[model samples]
Target: MTANVQNLNAERYSNEVFELWANQQNLNKSEDYLLKKYITDTSKHVLEAGTGGGRLSFYIEEKGFNNISAFDVVPNMIAHAKKRASTNDSNINFSISDAAVLENYESNSFDYLVYLQQVLCFIDKKDLFTNALKEAYRVAKKDAIVMFSFLDYESKIYNPALSSFVNVLRKLRSEEQSSRHLPWLKINNDINWKLFHKNQPKTYWVKRAEITSLLEDIGFSIEEVKNANQFSKNTGKRKGILYVVCKK
Candidate 1:
């Protein structure tokens, strides 16, 4: 299940359309606020996980951050980011690496870590999610600050649609569905308002308490938990998505 989820996510993000879309995006309000508020030292070594198209990394570089290392599991996304870096003449280190396993990064190396864009919730199972969190803890320096985002299970937007039906069928056959697994089963027309639908990867929606418990268990001190919209004072929008800051 883990391999399948990983492969599907890689393929989904590797799509040319999605890559272009990701590349064009800038730091959202929550991300911008967190970076401004928490990351005071730009010269310190920073690591970013699931850095799709180098969006956040590019933003950080523009803010005078010199020692930044960013990685994404999808090869094409990393390739696109490298191309962007070359075009911009930036020195941000971009690589292909999985969040669940940071085999290439040294322990206690990064002074800060970035895991935004709801990247953690993409892992299929709880154990793998824990492993990913454990990796985050291992790679961070003492007192290193880490910021991550997750899809909120309490948000009605994440309530199972295709997953609900799929899980019912699986249960009838005595087959287990991966926990909190919700697939992108609806049409998204955000690209120039043109409707398109595709069978894509699943993302796990997590309860607020559940993620906090896991982070604390993995030895991170929780700093703050806020709805993504709170940063913009737009409390009514995107209510179920959350961003959290912690210290190692």
Candidate 2:
């Protein structure tokens, strides 16, 4: 079953809320580095899974990449993305589709596949996640690249304030029980306060060894695994996220 939070009208949340926490820290530069480093210079076909609000898509467009496509499971989010695309006069394709299933698209049609922020964490099942990767590989060119960022579970556990807040939100969402088992979080309650609190999936803190092994098992060659903070020096003391790039 899909997470209850995924069923919520996420587009109702202001776009500003998505940027509020990261904007202050200049994390966009780090994200840009991940994009530039993994995305091939010759790549024209690109796909972004779970492209929420199209913030990163806009950045990709600004970097002059044409033939970009993005999709989100939430229809409202797609509506907002379409609106944003219209406002910006961008011709990028936007669609509403589940991340776990991309079979409708033609195979070997893309050169790069990107999953930004906590998109991986939002997928609740390991098989589903693996299938998504398989689909990415199928849709990408023989040597195409797939890049994504993930939270470091170790860092989250060590931070008292953040951990406490996370636990509280998880409790409110009724996800505390399964939080440790799955990467994605599900908030079942419709309470306004809980909605505002925002509980996210627990970080798997995927180590380089495990990630590399998974990639190899899934027919991908591991290329780079860098602490996203390395690119954004201002991140300071929060070694909670890593950017990984793998080739098909």
Candidate 3:
């Protein structure tokens, strides 16, 4: 992640407004389906990246997945997760971690890897995104299942005109430019959010073919790929979030 985007995301997620993640009670239909279908072993070691407020961690633990390790780059998020775990007497180990540089974890350590919540999109640069995927491959055991999710470039939510405008603006300023580099908007009531709204931070979007090719090149066997509507009844759109189930 670039320093500017990283700092922006840290500010966005660290705000108390995001602390509501602690009380997120259930997985969406897509997450629920993917988890039940590919990750059925209750005893396996599960590592969840970008575990905002421990939502997935808490759900899986409640479902009997005892060996769970979850992390996020934002310390305030991790603090909230740890506090929730303590309150619930949960066994999950919540920690501060960056997916692109997981120095604290050893190679071939986890049996299952969960990179959902469209966490990869937050990485606005391609090289750092690839590095993060490589880190996932390194920490996962051979043949371990890795579930990933990405923001779909084809989604109706992505406005091509806005993307083009952003590209032109950045190019004029001699900044890096791509159609996939779109701004993050304010979705909460943080007092300082308007400042960020004016100077928008970006998130990278991906297409199915692009991510499929990248994952295969990085030594993962693509097992399944589904768009939002295909994966969940609630999504109601064909081109929203994309989910992929892969193996090392």
Candidate 4:
């Protein structure tokens, strides 16, 4: 089952496609802010789950984090990450591992754990997310920081233009094999063809209350939930992202 999921992800987002998608998204400002907030005044071990292409991990390394490890479920993604590390001469340990299962990492082994963007949504299992949280908590010292971001559903409904743009992009990616807007090569398999045709890849939306409640249920207290509008002074329509910082 895990292998199937990995293969799907690999086929959907190959190295070229992943690079193109990463380049298209102007996420550096937000990612930099979040990384600074999480990696401040601490010299403890850090782990980035779902570290596709080692993009965020590399950014964190550039910001002076010495002890950092990264993992992705897809082997091809991990391979791309390794190539990235070598190209940049970074010493990050890139591995292929499931975020939901962290039994190999010993208890109290890390001081920080981060999941950028929509890493949690890809799990497809609430129990798996809960278990991942539990494992993160177990492997962190008291007061360790865990930070992540998600789509704010409330804000999303207010931006029809952006919503329509996303829909059009999805449609283009699904229908046009030669669309350079997407990074992955054209998939020819029937299952993949049906999957892509039926499911448009849009952002996953979660309510603030639901996120806070989940953190609390998982034995972490939320330190802050920074709406994107607060930092940018943009209207609610522009603040489609939410960043949550919690302490374990």
Q: Which of the numbered candidates is closest to the native, going by highest lDDT?
A: 3
| Cα error of candidate 4 at position 94, Å | 1.1
lDDT of 3 by residue, 140-201 (tens): 99989999999888775546876777777777767764567677644554434442233455
Q: Over all chains combined, what TM-score does candidate 2 have?
A: 0.73
Against the true structure, what is each candidate's TM-score? 0.88, 0.73, 0.90, 0.74
Tens-digit lDDT track of model 4 for 69-127? 88877677788889878988998888877767875577877788887765655553455
Cα displacement (angstroms), candidate 4, residue 111, comes to 1.0
Model 3: per-residue Cα lDDT at residue 124:
54
The CA lDDT at 29 in model 2 is 66
Query: Which candidate number would show the highest TM-score if scored against the true structure?
Result: 3
lDDT of each prediction vs. the true structure?
0.79, 0.64, 0.82, 0.65
Q: Ranking by TM-score, best first?
A: 3, 1, 4, 2
* For model 2, the run of ten residues with the poorest summed lDDT: 180-189
RMSD list, candidates in order:
3.5, 5.8, 2.8, 7.5
Worst 10 residues of 3 by lDDT: 189-198
lDDT (10s digit) by residue, model 2, range 38-141: 66564478898877678777777777887899987766566878888898899889997776678558888878888777576555555666676677777888
Cand. 4 Cα-lDDT: 0.65
